[model samples]
Target: MALSLDTIGPDTKNTAKGRLEPAMPPENRLEMPTQSLGRWSASQERKPVVDRSRWRTYLARLFVFGGGLILTGYGTYEMYQVVSVSRTTVLQWLLVALFTVNFSWIAVAFTSALLGFFALLSQSRGRGPLPTTLSCRTAIVMPVYNEQTSRTYAALEAIHESVEATGLGAHFDYFILSDTTDPEAWIAEERAFLALRQRLGPQARFFYRHREKNHHRKAGNIADFVMRWGGHYEHMLVLDADSLMTGECIVRLAAAMEADPDAGIIQSLPLIINRNTLFARLQQFAARVTGPVIAMGLSVWMGRDGNYWGHNAIIRTRAFADQAGLPDLKGRPPFGGHILSHDFVEAALLRRAGWDVYMLADLDGSYEESPPSLIDLSARDRRWCQGNLQHMRVIGAKGLKLPTRQHFATGIMSYLASPFWLFQLIVGIALVLQTTYIRPEYFARDFRLYPIWPRFDPERALALFALTMGILLAPKIFGTLLMLLRGHERRASGGGIRVVLSSLIEIILSALLAPILMLIQSGSVFQILLGRDTGWQPQRRDDGSIPLRDIVRRHRWHTVLGLLSGISAFMIATSLFLWMSPTILGLLLAIPLSWLSGQLGAGLALKRLGLLRTPEEFRPPAIAIRANELQQRNATFGYDDQDGLLSLYCDPELRERHVEMLSPTSRRKRGEIETDRALAEAKLGDAETIEDVLAWLKPKERIAILKDPALLTRLVGLKSGTSAIKAAE
Candidate 1:
């Protein structure tokens, strides 16, 4: 047999392949690693595990982080206390009455706090009621193409098995909803769904549908499902390809829907729990632990008003259909295209129509696997940015209520949260210094020494500290108690010292990651707002280690921002740091923290020392038992070898390896055009349908290809349309 990496390729770490080319050039990419390709040495190919000596190994970061959390909790409490007191006792002699009035300051702070409070309440601990009788015959929808049906089906089957295990599987159905453009993958999905249907018998209803036209990508595929089979059920539960929620949670979502007929949507916080690479592992750990506090806080605050994330949520059919009609954009690509981020707007629409949208906080067993690497996460975010930005158009459209506007505003600002935080933190430092160093002012009610503007009276400081600590720590206490009250912590947290310690460790890591992420998300959000795009890229779905150069390439701007941020902090706030050592240290740590934000340094170091190795024990049992079957992912990519392979084509390990093995040079020679074209055509074979032919087009230029050669060829074959294909091959 020829050296064919066309199957899983040489970079066979996880199901989703990794890089097959040289590191992305700095000019073309941002927020990537430094030494990208060489990071994953041959010996490091495996999955992530809890560092047994995690303490021993990551000891330096652990103590630094644990100490940092204490400082954050303590300092934020103190800092906010200062702000609250100052806000209440307005300065007497002020140059600007606007500053004295604190109009915008109070407006934004209370607005954020108010919104935060609402968001907090929305993640309430209590379940409204469980369904005594299943009112809605549900269909849990999973869509996939040639990409990775096995992983998709596996997650679907796991969820199905989980539901069946509950004995309520009969009320629920499974749809392997596909917009797959590949014959092999689509055929595999058909066979798999049939097998699943057979295996489940009548315990569960299983259906598989693949659209001949995958017009709107995910949204289009889903709309097709609703248009066709939606009427059969009152509600539908949707899952992304990488999403896997345990059985009990799906049942709970259904039950919640049944219990509350007025509830238009109930979204489970689809947190990431398991991943293999260091980046994915860190994210997964953070989501599982910090997620509850943040989620519960938001849910408690949001109450019956919440935005819908695209998947891992249950939605009411009639309500969504009635209110959530999406109109195509007339503008340019990216934003003007179809509504990419449809979940939030649909939720907003549902609420506008007077239905409740709830986000359940501690809905146990709701889980998902993380994007296996940082590169994957960034790619997904790019698509989401485009989708969510499209909603900016819907914000001002008539008929949306105040709460609906709140949701939309929240959605738009969520991406900008990072940018906002970055600006606030920088300005906050400046304001802090001005207050201390600038000339003191006499306030209306003060006595002794004339205090600074918005005077940092110590009493005011204490109260803010207490209030903030309560807000931040309350969720942890609340989540722990609820689980303990439910008597499920042992199962939920993994029990004993290991679980408790893990939770603490997770919190610390999360804190370190936050500011860095704040920068990334800010850049991402603002870039979207500015119409500077991070395009639709697929995630890294495997356990391969990333090279340093890769990190530098992807995230150079981050490096630049971190270095600048740290330098500024040192320059302007040198005195304040000496006053508050911890805060100063935290501020100073921005450089290294930003550098290692993705745990890029740690991952590299781990691989070098054989510390970050993926353990076999962590591999899914399915992969071990069905090794041959698992590795037999003959899923063809929906790509054309024409135009020297688009970015994503070379992104996947399998395709990249195939290209390398097929031809050593990444670039194809001009004279070999006919030869390679023949090879590519041979691989395409006779595309079963014109749709398959189109899926392989330069995905970015999908619209431009309407007047394409292949389409003309098909039209010529039709003998009914004008235009002809010149190729006789």
Candidate 2:
């Protein structure tokens, strides 16, 4: 009666030729979930009322956005006036347009940050008190690809323990949904799942499933679960491999959902943690400091029409199933095909169906990690760039809310803005070149009182540049001031002076890294435009150091481009060279910058110096500490290098567990050719031992053999002593 992994046993009642059959009924099988096969009707759902506060939010946005546009327009007019004193040619007009576009991007950011600062300052108190126990079942699902089994399972175990501590553990179930492709990784996940079950004991409400085909990747993985077991649970909490949430936060989210019937999804703000690399540490500091202010502003403006960040959020299972069934887009990849960035689109769909999506900005104890280096970050950015660009197709989808379209537009612009900035720089250089080199045709067109001189008022230009820099850096200034105002946070960050010093260092580093990111993102945009598709790959989470040669290979082009641009600017004018010095310097040092970004020693040295210290790093949260402890405990059991077939052949219990977890395939039509099964059978017949099987079979053949029950039977009957072992050697 005790709940355990083994209790969910194989079908003992049914057998075919003495082989055990799957225990579950056909409808309840792992592969087949009862699906509601039809388009969800919007007319049946009650429409959501517009929030009254939206009027005030709209007014605020208009004042801020309109003021920014007016300011940028004035700046553009001044630049035009400066160019008009000289020959007003096509080149000058192009420069004006570029400047306006680039300036508007930053102007909007500045105003948003200013609004965010006010919102943070005016935030109200906590969400009253916790409710007494009474709720529907919630499943906490962690969908994984090829990842380190120890870390992922350890995080899950820690989370399970945290939730159990709250006395609400019985109301929740845990699932490890794997889409792992690598055979080794797949076996490792099974081993880890077993180990986790043992550690938690028999009654632990934990389950694991590995798909034969990844299908539509992650979206498909979740959909498979929803269609199958989703009928049992009222709500589902989604977590990434690296995600960690405290029990209090989880309980609060569930209680809030129960209180609001119209709520479809609720998102929590996840802060970065456990990062040691220099780049990662800097990112952690910035995210911890400035992320809250921006989130508060967004929450105030968006209200119930917010966004989902894919993880660290909970969704109403029925609402998501009925409303968020995504259809494939038309045509080929990089534009058409399956949705890569599915979370945003899901949120839009839910909203379009009259369900409210909200974000809890003030909620704490939610945590995640960042990539360790600039190169790693850029690699991840490449996938995101492609995904965001694909949203142009979805932005025009029928019945989507206006704010949802804006969200899609914002995602698209986050990548496009980089190329815009780069183009602006190129155009500015061209304008300077024309002014300094080409002679003004004073008498060619219309008669003039004086010969036109291509020139700018240097003092006014310098003042304008100063204003732009101030606007761009104002968010950092406000974030720092806010931290200093709070007594506990200031102390946790190593005092006001240290916090101030850290902010300055962060600013300088961010400035140097900006141009490098600009170039990387611009290349990503170019590649996507050229029809290059970025395939899904697991992210590297751990950090130590990267090789110097690898850094050089990745950033060599950036360095070369920097040198060429720097030399060209200097040759044109000292002022132009001076103006471009920051970008040039960042580019010229790209290799070294990237190298230092991944250096653990450099980051630790800063920690020793009391720089870039966050509250979490100083005090260390309970959930984070527990995760590390579990990870270390799990690390002692190392995985075997032998293939899946070899490992399963050696262990009877493992083979049984694996067979029990597989989807029932006995109902396949007669004479249907299973390529894997046929090839596996052919290869197994000629094999003399386990070693022969390993040597003769390819990776695909091995996977096929492992999945087929008949092939596994032959594998288990093979000779298993010193002769077979020696053959393997």
Candidate 3:
């Protein structure tokens, strides 16, 4: 388990006994140039056998889109008949347009789920046998931000151990790429890195790098890795901080890549796991039960032109470096600058270069965690909404494939749908108010045989409503039936009866949560359209309840709006009130529902009742089990709980090691007037003791000092007064 310090640590030529050593692996450089978005040339590699797949893809697309069009047309005609009974009005046309948009959205999904249903019935999970050995090396890179060191490092350790167990560990190496802006989190990452190395032994290929500046966020962190050290490996399997995969799955992905030389990216469908909150468990259940069907449909129809979900996907290093380099768009935040949703763009670029991108839906063992609560989900969705809206600028880029463009449209619509739904509701409400209260215009400028009435045939309206509900709910039914029909899947999801019951519970909960999320997403879209940006924030992984006041503050307006909508609907008609009850009740319960979404006790109660039980909960994966065990052991270090500057000042060894790890730099450029660094230098010069420096330094100043060896040394020279912060204390 031991190795010479010379290979992985700082130079020890003049080192004292008490000095700490650097905990970094040796450098292996690779050049990955930023790609040009304006022009692209297809790769000259041998293409895969795709004649049959091409036909299948065309049929699938035609079936889904054509069927959707047919459904939309029928629904539109029915609405036209209902409204054009006497004469059509402006409000009626608006209603029809909104209805068409909303109906088409679900119609497409309904048709696709039908495709998925049939595909599932006949699809095979067999991928033959795993390759005996690998011909190329892969770098499993996990890009991290300001994250909990213990949880991330523990997950990494588990993944590494799982890979090693397969005896193909020699072909793989792991890297922890950090873009942490938090100084304490940065140091904690280093400490955890060292601990992991010691535990895994020198035979394990583990590396760590922390960026001084988080320029492009995660995309930048990974780009830094690719530019610096990507050449040594044939493929890079990207992992998020919460991602974990089995050794078998890892090897199989590598094998798939090796087998398909045309493949640029191979994405594994990662299911949700290790979640406890009511919201999270609901997500976990839906993903485990229904995700596979949807993914299978996507994979089948998408063929080799599939999209990436950022992480838990393996990419050809050469292909990605050559074609997938992202460019900042023109303009400002929200719609401009560096691409926020880089995964879709990267896939498009790769496909544009004539490389295949595939999503392996049947590949089990890829796992990721979800945001634990409604508030947490809303926070994450805001960022996604902003990112997806930015894709509008990329959709028309030259040389992009049709499917690639469709992917962009789909992403953009996912966020925009919320606002569209809200607008549709408003339009419907306006129509209802006009019918109930507004004076009808009996006279027209032009000669008319009959006067228009702002009313719909109740029978036709009711029939259309039934059809819309069927289209909307078909996918869930398809997924549930598919699960029930399969003995293994049915058993894995609890018994058939329990599975049905759980599906119903998830459906009901989702219905209640939909209106709330709709409002949240609608607001996000509005803000983005107004040129407001949503900055990246770390997701809350634990099932921690938000403050009651915060929940009330967030949902108060939604509650009031719901009440008003209900009152108006009831006044309009009893039928209207009944029709709108789901939406009204959902918005009315937003605050309390949000509160319960994060409650551990409520989620556990459901679990005890055998509801929302994922197969992973029934038979936990070995890697997941190992990860939990290591998380407990690693968390005992409590590195994140310490103050970075104070810990270094009190512990000389850590200070020395911190200095040794900084990239060798000359003096600051003469013309440069960096505010933070300059301020840090001035404060350190004036400080007489450690406490003075601690009190004087801002976060930016602290980061500047932490990155500069000279400033660190100056801080180390400060006096340790009685009031000085100490690591022991």
Candidate 4:
């Protein structure tokens, strides 16, 4: 596909004075052909071969995975002893198996944290210096779905300013690759694009393109750009809608790519920022405090075979176009279609093709936002769960390395662990119920010397529980200790005492929230396993407040289950009730806990008292502040406030720009009809006024009308009332 630079109007003689047409940057074409999953050339030559067998990588992997296995073995034996006071029943054996799986999961984390803690102490946590210049051009692209145009565009503007400040701005081009399906959002983006370009002037290399068909979602959006314009640049820095990075970081990343000819993708660790709601703040704190340790550990072991997290990463354009074309999995829906989690697969494919994929653990200035509420988080998690679960198919694709496969396995287990934990809990409860209520088989049919008793070694079980908790908390502990030891970090986070208090608060809150999330994820896993698909949806990105009735309605079942389980545990034994207290408490308070998750007041009150205060919150980054200011300024312009039809109806120049930017529609075949288009045409023909069309048109019909030039021309000719489409109902 050869995309041409679109210059809207060559003749501006009749134009209003001082008015300028929105001109897009000339397209630098590239061809990105899709690659096959089942076929690849093993003998293909590359500049640099990634040495997975390097001693450091080998030793790191050995320490992490090998240590996890050794710990799992010891933990399994202790669990067996706790359960096997006598002849082990099926339930006891199953419990031990579950224990082994769950134990190994944390054991890996514990081992990784140990390695990361030492690595951090020894290594400097900084990219040496920003490069003064770069010889190669890079495209900084952000793919937007049905997101708020103000926020997304504002972020781009801020990044643009930051990049220009580095004096390397000429080497970078910015593209807003929009996959927006929303009619209003589509126009709003165009309006913002024009206004933003005008503000930045003609010399700024900013462009916008909206896909007619949002095929394959985000991956397709990016692939479309790569196929059309990727060849212009040596590398592409992909950013999420919520992603923000400093000029130094962007320049450094491009320089790093220039320095390493074999580097395919270098992912940066993005810390969460600008969150005010309690759940978002909790996440922000946790990611700031402990996320680095975990990320550093993954970097140590992953080495050149690291994973891409979809955004905040720079990819070599040629390598991605050649090797990372994702193949659709066979079958249907969640598992059979286009890959949802394309980043990990892309990284693996690049590695399979002998390109080095890396994670720059020390890289900073990359940042992103978290979902503001539990419900919002769960909604996002559902899509992620389905995506990760889909990896089960691709893990076996030809030519993937063992570590790449391990990455796949780890992703799969991340979601699967929830179900495993839930099942283990249920089985543990069942064991207790049997012991308390069901009669035990005393004498065997063979006439055993003594009667068998259904019992666990209380002391050993308690010790095992302690060990499990220790392992689970090790990463957080290490993170806290590191913060306290570093004077700058300690002072930034409100001193050692406040840091300790905040960590404690985070630990307690996370403990309370874990059970709820476990149940949510477990349900998602079951749904995906049953062949259910989680469709794409735009995440809510503001203060995620919910109505009282909605909160109760959502969490009532959880509360009831918690109550029943608590009652049963108490009825079974005091020890059992005590053991299950955390889970029970979390589930029982699900409604209020969920409400608190979105409460800005609670989060702010804590902020005032210096609890959950991240270093970023104390010293706000200039880029973040500028983005927020631009967002507010953009909001005031009412670009996002107007409906698509009304915006076009009101502004003739915008309508012209919109029509010019639309990709030429293909000719329909004989007997072919677009359902939405047909419906939209019929409605447009019947409509007497713009008000009538706005009142009667469905969302799909609106989109269809917006896309059809003829229909939009008719919509433009409609009689209007004194007022346009109202922003409020």
Number of the predicted model whose TM-score against the real structure is largest: 4
Clashing pairs in 4: none
User: Over the stretch 364-411, how does candidate 2's per-residue lDDT look in tens digits?
Assistant: 879999999998899999989998999998888777778888789889
Q: Against the true structure, what is each candidate's TM-score?
A: 0.61, 0.91, 0.94, 0.95
Name the lDDT of candidate 4: 0.86
The CA-based lDDT of model 2 is what? 0.81
Evaluate model 2: give its TM-score: 0.91
Model 1 scores a C-alpha lDDT of 0.52
Candidate 1 residue runs with Cα over 4 Å from true position: 1-136, 165-171, 180-205, 246-261, 269-271, 276-286, 293-306, 333-335, 359-363, 373-375, 382-390, 428-500, 564-573, 576-729
What's the lDDT of the predicted structure labeled candidate 3?
Answer: 0.84
TM-score head-to-head 2 vs 4, winner: 4
For residues 16-65, what per-residue lDDT tens digits would candidate 4 score against the true structure? 22435434455667766676767766786365743435799999999999
TM-score, model 3 to reference:
0.94
* Residue 126, model 2: Cα distance from true site in angstroms: 4.3
Across residues 357-407, which tens digit of lDDT does each residue of candidate 3 receive?
989888888999999899999999999999999999999887889999999
Superposed model 4: Cα runs more than 4 Å off: 1-26, 45-53, 666-672, 723-729
1-729: candidate 1 lDDT, tens digit per residue? 111124212223222222222211111111211111112233322221221232331432233334445544554444544565444333222212222222222233332333333344454456555444565688788867455555666666667666776777778877776666543444345444444444455445666555555776776677667765677778889888777776667888888887776788899886664454556655655554445555654564466667788888998876666656666666766567567777776776667666778887667656566665555566676676666667777777555555567666656665655555455555556566566567656664546464546545567545654554454554444434433343344444444444455445445655655655665676667676677645444455655555667765665665565556556556666644443343334334544443454554465454444322222222333323232243344222211112212221222332232222221232334455443344335434555533344455443233222212343233223211112111211
RMSD of each: 15.9, 5.4, 4.4, 4.7
